[model samples]
Target: MIKVAVILTGVLLLAAYLVLLERKLLGRFQARIGPNRAGIFGLLQPVSDGIKLLTKEDVIPQGAHRRIFLFAPAVVAATALLTFAVVPMGPDLHLGGRKIPMVVTDMNVGLLYVFAMASLSVYGVVLGGWASDSKYAMLGSIRGAAQMISYELALGLSIVPVVMLAGSLSLVDIVDAQAGRPFILVQPLAFVIFFLSAMAESKRIPFDLPEAEAELGSGYHTEYSGMRFGMFFLGEYVQMQVLGALTAVFFLGGWRGPFLPAPLWLLVKIVLVVTAMIWIRATLPRFRYDQLMGLGWKFLIPAALINIVITGFVMVGI
Candidate 1:
């Protein structure tokens, strides 16, 4: 219970600050200033933003399905937080002759658990859009549903080689398999597929068709307000961090570094991955819907499948 509380608190705080980090980075990318008024260098901007959201009016559209509308954002936030339960941050602590694993629950099927959570998160968008009773919201949700489902195939397939190499679905086991060397070295293609698929899974930048402001008017959560809206906002950032951590676990040698503590190494890897994500956002325009779907279905999926076959053949030969 203590571990769960600590993890949740840490995730929320990190997610809040990540927004600030993205803004700061984006400001630099665009040659402008980010939030600089709330505190020293806008360090406290997230706090103020949190306060404002908490104090603001929680408004539901008149025609909205009150129950589903109210519940949707929580779905998004909760799933993202729950994903951390199985993510091992470092080596287990040995205290008072007792072993405490770094992860909340080191399930044998942790990878499957992660995908289940990702699948569940889609419901939040679907429910929010459907309950809002707005055409734009519905369209956005439909797009999100299609996009997520399409990319999820590639996302799952991309990791097949890793699973084959590691011979386990457990993330901890996968990390252990990479002790001699990171998977990125041997499975660059899978890493690329996973990286691109993860970006799409997180609905970042080029894959952000669902929330295309010009087309969808704030997308699935168009009718949300106050902390309800904040929940959805928080979910996106948390998912970003989760995906970053997964990337680290799968390819970057989770927590393994020469001079840093294990946890710090993991954190550094995650931040690097996240920074690249933000940079991609700054540089790439959103993909057209057809183009997005085509890439996921036609390209990433087939590539992942072929990579898996090649990996299988190599393993057999060895």
Candidate 2:
């Protein structure tokens, strides 16, 4: 119970600040100042934003399905948070002669659990958009769902090689397998594919066709406002953090580094992965819808398949 509370609080706080961090980085990338008004360097900006969202008027569009519209955003936020349950941030700690694992729950099928939660988040987008009774919202949700589903295939495929090499689905076991060297060194191709696919799955820029402002009018959340909309926003950043953490767990040797506490090492790696993603968001343009689907199906999927085959051969040969 204590572990769950700590993880939930930590993840929610991180998600809130991640928005500020992205804004600051983006301002710099654009050669301008970011949020420096709310507090010293806008340190309290997320707090102000939270207050505003909470106090703002929550609206339900006329003719909308009120229950589903209200419920959908929670689905996204909940699934994203739940996915963290199996993510081990550091090695076990011995306290009072009791062994405490770093993760909330280290399921043997941790990888699959993560994927299942990710897959469930799509329903929030679809249901929210559909319940809104807005054509724009419906279109955005459809595009978002299709894009997420398409990229998921590549994302799932990209990790097969990692599982083959690790010979276990448990994330802790995967980390243990990498003690000699990170998988990024051995499965470079899988790493690249997984990274790209993850960005797409998270609906980051260049893969953000679903939320294209000019086209979708703010996309699936077009009809959302106040704290309701905030939940949807929270889900995106949280998903980014979740994917960043997964990337570290799979490729960077989770929590493993010399001269640092294990959890701090994992935090450092997650920040690096997330910063790179923000850079990509600032540097790249949204892809044309066809191009987005094409890259996932024609390129990433095929590359992942080939990588899996090669990994299998290497494992058998050695």
| Tens-digit per-residue lDDT, 202-281, candidate 2 | 88998888789999898999999999999999999999989999999999999999999998898889889999999999
Question: What is the per-residue lDDT of model 1 for residues 1-318, given as tens digits with 9 covering 90 to 100?
Answer: 999998888888889999999999999999999899998999999999999999999999999999999999999999999999988889889999999898899889999999999999999999999999999999989999999999999999999899999999998999999999999999999999999999998899989998999998999988889999999999999999999999999999998889889888988898899999999999999899989999999999999999999999999999
Error of 2 at 266 (Å): 1.0
Looking at candidate 2, what is the lDDT of residue 211? 82
Please list the residue runs of candidate 2 whose C-alpha ends up more than 4 Å from where it truly belongs after superposition: none
For candidate 2, the clash count comes to 0
Kindly report which residue pairs in candidate 1 clash with one another: none
In model 1, which regions exceed 4 Å deviation? none
> Each prediction's TM-score against the native?
0.99, 0.99
Q: Which run of 10 residues does model 1 get worst, by summed lDDT?
A: 255-264
Q: Give the TM-score of candidate 1.
A: 0.99
Model 2 Cα displacement at 53 (Å)? Answer: 0.7
Quantify all predictions' global Cα lDDT against the true fold: 0.93, 0.93
